[model samples]
Target: MPPVTLKDVAQHAGVSHQTVSNVLNGHPHIRPTTKERVLASIAALDYYPNQAAKALREARTTTVCCVFYGHNPEDISDPYRNLVQSAFIAEAQAHGYSITTAFVNDDADLTQLRQRFLQREFGGAVIVGTVLTPSQVHTFQAWEMPVVLFDHALPSTTNVTADYPEGMAALVQHHVLQGRRRLALIIPEQDLGSTSIRRREGFLQTCARAGVEGAVYDGTWSYDAGYRAMQALWAGESRPDAVLGGNDRIGAGALRAAHDLGLRVPEDVSISGFDDFEFAQFTTPSLTTVHIPHGDMARQAVRGLISLIDGTESESRVFPLSLVVRESA
Candidate 1:
């Protein structure tokens, strides 16, 4: 079938296309009964406004840049990152906008990207993942361009982030409530971003409140990191009764390491993770993890940036994470 248009709706309603437009745009001159008829016709025809033509007439550029500050192009393959990227793309396209992706590997690359952004190369930008340095972040703060920051917390900026503290606290509470007093947390060796920092803060505070013993181990954002963190923790004279990973990737690694060391999950030790990635549910005993709303966050980030570009106010939004209980914990 052909695409439904304003004219089609107008014809079905037995009115001019301009009348349909007037009704759709909330023009007050139209009668209530007439508006009802036009709306009914619209519903029947399933007509949608042509955003592409509207943007063209308004002289609005439909291109936005999604910059990954501290990640390599290869990093986009990670499940969390992949989900966010795909979601943003779909949402932007739905709004008749396009996304251009750029990767900033280091400080030098970040500086150069800033220069391009200053030239008005994009209608707006969504900063995803992480940043390389404090100065690089400062550059984003001082820029005149409309931008949305994701996963990072900064005053006076539009941000979209998950409730990391609450998620981490729930994980800690789950383990401690099950009578696991001694715990270990495995996190990325790279500079802990705002999300990681918040998670750590929650873990520490919750452990203190519950009178549980917990320790942090540094590792990468990968399976090896979880594996190595567990190995290092076991190298000591004692072992934790439970282990929590920063993300599912690390959690899966911890599970592997534990099995390799002849330990049983939730029997010898309980293990849980953040970001309930697909693999989390498929582990030997199904890992318990935190479920972050990645798709929703991506949509919000895109909408916020578009709002900024349209000279509208968009406030920062923090979404809550849910705990997924499973046999691993």
Candidate 2:
């Protein structure tokens, strides 16, 4: 992309191109009235006088920041975040750029990230596998660089995400049709970002529409977390006949929890999940799940970010989700 040229100021100022330059450089003895015309022209174009602005256009724009939020240091190893990031890295490498992992765990980390990137060392960023509170969102927006969000959406930003509501609705409808009136869901104790919230809301809405009793359990995005939630949900005498996991990993954990509690699969309680991960079909009874195309989303995010970095047109896109039925459900 080319920077605005002297022709821009000349178009309105009707002065020699050097006249605008003289005005900007604070040349002495220029008519104050004439200088104001060039100044006004610069302001109208929203041109930045800082060298950073110029360096931005001159920079190679070949590096991409890969940012993911971690609640704790251990969350840096989150499988879901890793898989999604790996996909982005692969695509970014294919596009002749390197991906730099940015682990953001707290406000201090976030502030440092924003400052470091403001140096324009990275062309843009792809933020995935995290929740952004309103303040966090503002921090990211302050980067003043192209960005693509995965599994989340924000105004004025490009986003690539699977249609969570569609997938959750399919899962809910499938369970309700099986005569499972008492359904329960296990989701991250946190909002888990827009995608997770969308799934939760979709389940609730679909359940209400189906006139079935639906309950939700707070759990993290792991099999162990799912296991604990299942244990707690089933401990009560009034148990749900069907349960949904936030993801396949959680579903697998829930399956084990049922077995440990002397319960049968499907026969005792139907189990299903989102993110039909590769091992879903290999689970005990196989796991029924919503297949979110994370790979496709990552590819789209990379493409969109590249387009923005190159000063081309890029629009946000939403991918549809599909439900995969297996024995577990």
Candidate 3:
């Protein structure tokens, strides 16, 4: 059968095509009874609006784009990205919108980036984990499209982020309570400029208050970074009794390094991680890490974007993080 059209609904409801259009667009001029009759006809015919047709009529696209900029595209493969993106997808679908993804390597051309978004006819954008250059952000602002930013600081654009400081403090407090006198923190060097920086601040402040000596190691937020940082710690004359990683991947790497060096977890040394990824449980000893609620953060980000699209103002939101205790710590 041919696709159902507004004309069919108009004919069935005994109204003009314009009346059906008004009802669909929420023109607020149609009679209540007339609106009901038109809606019933639409349902009876199982009419679904063609998005292309609606876009043509409204002169606006119904799609949003998300651009992620970073040193390595693989960084998003972390569990944090997985959870946030998953939530964003589900929430966008619920709001009758779709998302497009783009990547920008460091120092890419702004004009080229704009062309990509234009080619896709993106109605708006959500940038995740990318530190937008001031000019890039200005470009998006100039386009006058709704934009939401995540993980990076942007003036003028709305943002959603995790409470890294509080989460880090909790992790350190846990270690202190466990009687860990010498503590160390391992973080990706890249993260020193972002959320990881906040985590470090929390850790150090807590350590000072608790009077525990603390050290920091700069590395990648990966298993390799964690392993290397741990190795470096072992080689040092004064080793920390406890180590905290920036995220779960780093934590896992630290665990491997400890195992290889004949240090039993929690018995010989204590280790912990953040972002309770899927692999956190299966490690030799289950990981005690901070659970960054990615799903919840994603949901909030999408909701904020939807509100923006609908011309509703949403307050800046922060999601809470929790500590998941297991054998490693």
The best-first sequence of candidates by TM-score reads 2, 1, 3
**Candidate 3 lDDT trough over 10 residues, lowest sum:** 106-115
lDDT of 2 at 223: 87
Task: Summarize candidate 2's per-residue lDDT along 1-329 as a digit string, tens digits.
Answer: 56566677767788888887677665888897787677777656645444466575467668898877654546664567767878999999999998887877764456446544655668888877457665666667665667787778877778787788889999999999898999999997577678788988999999999999988899878889889989998888889999999888889999999989999899999999889888889988899999988888898899899998898978889899998999988
Worst 10 residues of 1 by lDDT: 51-60
Estimate, for each residue in 72-149, the C-alpha lDDT of model 1 and write its tens digit: 687655887788889989999999998888887754355445544543446778998554345655566666668889
Best by TM-score: 2
TM-score for candidate 2, please give it: 0.79
Q: What ranges in model 2 sit over 4 Å off?
A: 1-57, 71-73
User: Model 1 misses residue 267 by how many Å?
Assistant: 0.5
Cα RMSD of predicted structure 3 = 14.3
Candidate 3 clashing pairs, residues 3+ apart or interchain: none
- The order of the candidates by lDDT, greatest first, is 1, 2, 3
Write the number of the candidate with greater lDDT, choosing between 2 and 3.
2
Model 1 TM-score, 2 decimals:
0.78
